[model samples]
Target: MPVGSITRGTTNTNRLRRVDRWIAEQPALRHAADPFVVDLGFGASAVTTFELAARLIRSRPDVEVLGLEIDPARVRTAREQLDRTRAGDGHFPAGLPVTFGLGGFEVPTPDARRPAVIRAFNVLRQYDEAQVDEAWRRMSARLAPGGLVVEGTCDELGRVSSWVGVTAEGPRTFTISLRRSGLERPSIVAERLPKALIHRNVPGERIHELLATLDRAWRVHAPMSVYGGSQRWIAAVATLRHEGWPVIGGPRRSRLGELTLPWDAVAPV
Candidate 1:
């Protein structure tokens, strides 16, 4: 039996684009011996899995995507969609390397093949904070050497999102990605943090301090908004790094309204 409960199964096309782009840049996928990825808990549609494969293939031609759902019904639905996709009845390429299966945190793969990356977006939002560690342990254990598990949540439209990158060693980085054009505040991501840090965004928590400081930096750089949101975002992130926030990445990423920090910087106290 699958090791998880049925979620709402809510999903939309291109809703996971930000994370896909980030994942594409990671060495785990780019240099994986198998270049296989698991889209754990893909919901009502297989479109995101297809999209992930489509995006990843550019970096790793042999990239194969497997969409997994704990609910047999969702799995069946995704397989049907995959059939139409293969038949060239959909917008996706007929030869897209994608598949669908029924599984959970156990992350079952044929021949017990471990994945280089297990993307469990929005899968943990409905779980208790206490359950996060165990889920991460179970999922990360299924990763191939040097592999990582990307677990996080995003808004329905995918405009606001945040995730944590976890490896066999443990959580390594926390990232926030947003639509820069009309973003009101970087802290808007607070609502979409992975379950582990969502409830931890209260006073005295390191995550809370990080968000509050980011908001301050954004406000200080509000004048740059006239130039463009991306410019303002870049400036805010630069300020964070200048002030010893342990931020990762450079202008290339901040221009996309994305900022990543070592997990220790925002880990719960």
Candidate 2:
């Protein structure tokens, strides 16, 4: 049995697109010899796992994706869905490099081959904050050298999301992604911070400072919104970089309403 509880299983097609797109861009998956990826706690539907495999295959043809869920019933349903797809009764590509399994933060694999990347979105939101470190440790231990653990949360529509990228060395970077249109403020994403940093968003916290700074920058650039949300977002992110936030990526990523910072900048406390 897996070492976690069953979640609400609330998922939709492309509900994880932002994180999946980011994962496909990562060197951890793109450069692995035979990249094995895990979708930990992959809800009731295996569609996200299927989509993950589809996106990654474009970067690494040999990439394999396994959707692991703590709920046996969910695993069985996903297997059945895969079966339907295999039998030409479903929409997914037949025989894609995907599988469904039962596992949790421990990340059990049939052949015991460590995976190159494990995506655990929305999995830890149900646990107490203190359990996050142990869960990260367990998952990171199952990673192959140079592997990555992307853990975070996203809205039901997948339009807004945030995640932390952890390696064996510990958390490395934090990212915020949102749909460009109707973005009220960059700080709106603070609500979706990963379990490790959610509660720490109070006074005197690095994450809080980061969000406050971003809000200030957004206000300073509000006039640019007349042109477009993307323009305003790029301006705000550029301002953040100028003000020494160690923002990662550049105009291209920022134009997509995404910003990344070194994890040390906001690692709890």
Each prediction's TM-score against the native?
A: 0.99, 0.97
lDDT of 2: 0.90
Q: What are the clashing pairs of model 2?
A: none
Clashes of 2: 0
For candidate 2, lDDT tens digit of each residue in 145-186? 999999999998999899999999899999999997887777
The TM-score measured for candidate 1 stands at 0.99
| Candidate 2: 10-residue stretch with minimal lDDT | 182-191
- Model 1 ranges off by over 4 Å: none
Which lDDT tens digits does candidate 1 get at residues 1-269? Answer: 99988899889989999999999999999889989899999998888999999999999999999999999999899989988888889898999999889899999999899999999998999989999999999999999999989999999999999999999999999999999887778899999999999999999999999999999999999999889999999999999999999989899999888999999999999
Each candidate: how many clashes?
0, 0
CA shift of 267, model 2, Å: 1.1
Best by TM-score: 1
Q: Could you tell me how far off, in angstroms, the CA of residue 70 lies in candidate 1 after the best superposition?
A: 0.5
Model 1, backbone clash pairs (residues 3+ apart or across chains), number: 0
* Highest-scoring model, lDDT: 1
Q: Least accurate stretch of 10 residues (summed lDDT) in model 1?
A: 178-187
Local distance difference test, each candidate? 0.94, 0.90
Residue 226 in model 2: shift from native, Å? Answer: 3.0
